[model samples]
Target: MEAEIRFGDFVREVSLRQTHISFNELAAYPKLDNKIVPINRQNEKLKVSLKDIYRILGPYTTVRFVDQVKAVIPLAIYLMFFQIFILRQGIADAALICGGLLSVMVGLMLFMEGLKLGLMPFGETIGNTLPVKSPLVVVLGISFLLGVGVTFAEPAIGALKAAGQIVSVEKAPYLYAMLNEYSGALVLMVGAGVGLAAILGTLRFVYDWSLKPLIYLSLIPVLLLTGYVGIFDPELAKIIGVAWDCGAVTTGPVTVPLVLSLGIGVASVVGRGDSSLSGFG
Candidate 1:
C-alpha cells in the first residue's frame, strides 16, 4: 500500500506492463505464512465508515476518470485541431461538444464499471461453475443463448438500426430495408453467427485446433457472397458496409468479455492436451 501510494500512476503503468512471473522467481519471496507488520504505515481495517466513503472512492474515481479521459480526450483534441488547422472550420458550440464528450467519458466509465462488477463476474462464475455441474450439451446451449442474448442487449445494435437516415433507399434498397423493416432479422442473424463463433472458439481452445483452417473456411463463404453481391447484384453491394458493421458490433461490449469468460470457463474444465496458448498454424 505504501509503495503504491508513493509512485501512484508510475507504479500502476509498470505493473500493467509486467509479464506473468512465478512466485519462486520473484525477489524477497516470502515462505512464511504469518502476517508481517510494516512499521512505516498504519494498517487500515477491512471495514469502513460512511464518512470514509469519499476517501475510499477518491483514488479509484480519479483512476477511472483519467482512464476515460485518456481514451476520449486525445482523439477529440486531435480531431478538433485537425478541423481548425486543416479544414479551416471553426468548432461550433464548443461548450456543448465538450459537455457531450464529458458525458461520453462518464458513460463509458460507468459502462466499464458495470461490466467488471456485475456482468463479467456473473459470466465468469457461470463459466467456472457450469462445466463442473452441467452436461456438455447444456453448456453449449447456454453459450448459444448467451451469444443471442448479448447481441440483443448490445447498445450499438440499437444505434445501428437508426443509421439508415444517411443511406439513400434508391442506391441501397436492401441495405435500407435491412436497417429498417428487416432490422430485427438482420440482428438475429448476426447474433446467431456470433453464437456459433463462440461455440467454435471454445471448442478450438479445448481441442487445440488450428485457427487458420477455421479462418479459411469462414472466409470462403463471405468472399463468395461478397463477390456475388458486388458483381451480379449491384443493388446489394452497398449492404456490404452494413454487413461489416453488423459483424463488427457483435464483438462489442456486451458480447466479448461475457462470452469469453463463459468460453474460458468451459475450456479450463474440458480442455485437452498441454497447450496453454494455440499458435496461428
Candidate 2:
C-alpha cells in the first residue's frame, strides 16, 4: 500500500508538470494564493485575486463609490426636505416621495457618468481633429460651434435667469420684465463670448503660444472696451461688469470640464509644432 501511494504521488506530479502553465497566465487567474502583492505609495499592501480582478473590470464592472454617495446624498436629502416640508409639494400620491428621490439620485449619477465618459471624450476628440489650414477661419468656426453648442445646455445661465427675477423683483417690481429680458440677453452674450473664446483658445493651442501674453492681449481689449463703455454711461459700466462676471458663472458644471479639456488637448497639439502656440496661450 505504501509503494502504491508513492507511485500515485509521482504520477500526479509528472502529470501536473506536463500541463505546463506560465507565470503571467497563472497571475491572470483569480486564486488568492497565486497572487503577487505589491506595496503602494501609501506603504500599504494590497490584495489581488482573480475574483477581485473580474469584479473591478469585467463585463458589467462597477466602481467602489463611497465618496460619490457621500457627496451627493446630503444634497439630495436637502432637496427632498425642501420639497416635502418647505415647499409643501408632493406627488399626486404618497408613494412618489421615494420614487422622486430615487429618480433624482439616479439621474444625477447618470449625468455625471455621462460627463466623464461622453463629454470629456468628445472634447478631446475635437481637439485632436482640428484642421491644419493656414487662414485660421476654419479652425475658429469649429471651436465657436463647439463652445456655443455646449454653452446652451449649461446650468449656470438658467440659474442666473431665475435668480435675476427674484432679486430684480424685490428691488423694483415694475422692472421685472425688463430684468428678464436683460438676463436673457446677458446669457446669449455670454454663450456667444464663450464660443469665441473657445475658438481663440483653439487657435492659440495650434500655435504653441504662451498663456501670459495672450491673457495680457485679451485684457487690453477688454479694458479698452470697459473704458469705452464707462465714458458713455456709468450705470452701463456697472451693468456690463456684472454681466461679464455672470458669464464666468454661466459656464457652470456642464461647460467647464468640456471646455478645459478641449483647451488642454488643443494646446498639446500646438505645442508639438514649431509655430506660435495653437490654442489658448
Error of 2 at 40 (Å): 54
Report the C-alpha displacement of residue 223, candidate 2, in angstroms: 7.0
Q: Write the per-residue lDDT of candidate 2 for residues 1-281, one digit (tens) a residue.
A: 12123476465445431233345643433333335644333432454678656644442222213334667679867887888899998635557656766666566667777886799768766665665433468767877887777777887667666765554555444345434766666666777888878876765555555568878987899888888987986545545646565667756778887887677556555556532223343
* Model 1 ranges off by over 4 Å: 1-53, 273-281
Candidate 2 deviant stretches above 4 angstroms: 1-65, 73-105, 132-135, 169-178, 219-241, 271-281
Task: Report the number of clashing residue pairs per model.
Answer: 0, 21
lDDT for 252 (candidate 1) = 86
TM-score of each: 0.77, 0.56
Best by lDDT: 1
State the lDDT of candidate 1 residue by residue for 1-281, as single tens digits. 12112367467545442234343433333344446743444434355455455555655676777899999988998999999999999999999999999999999999998997799768867876887888767877887888888999998899999897667887778888888888889989998988788778766765678778999999899999998988997777778888888988877888887876675556555655432232112
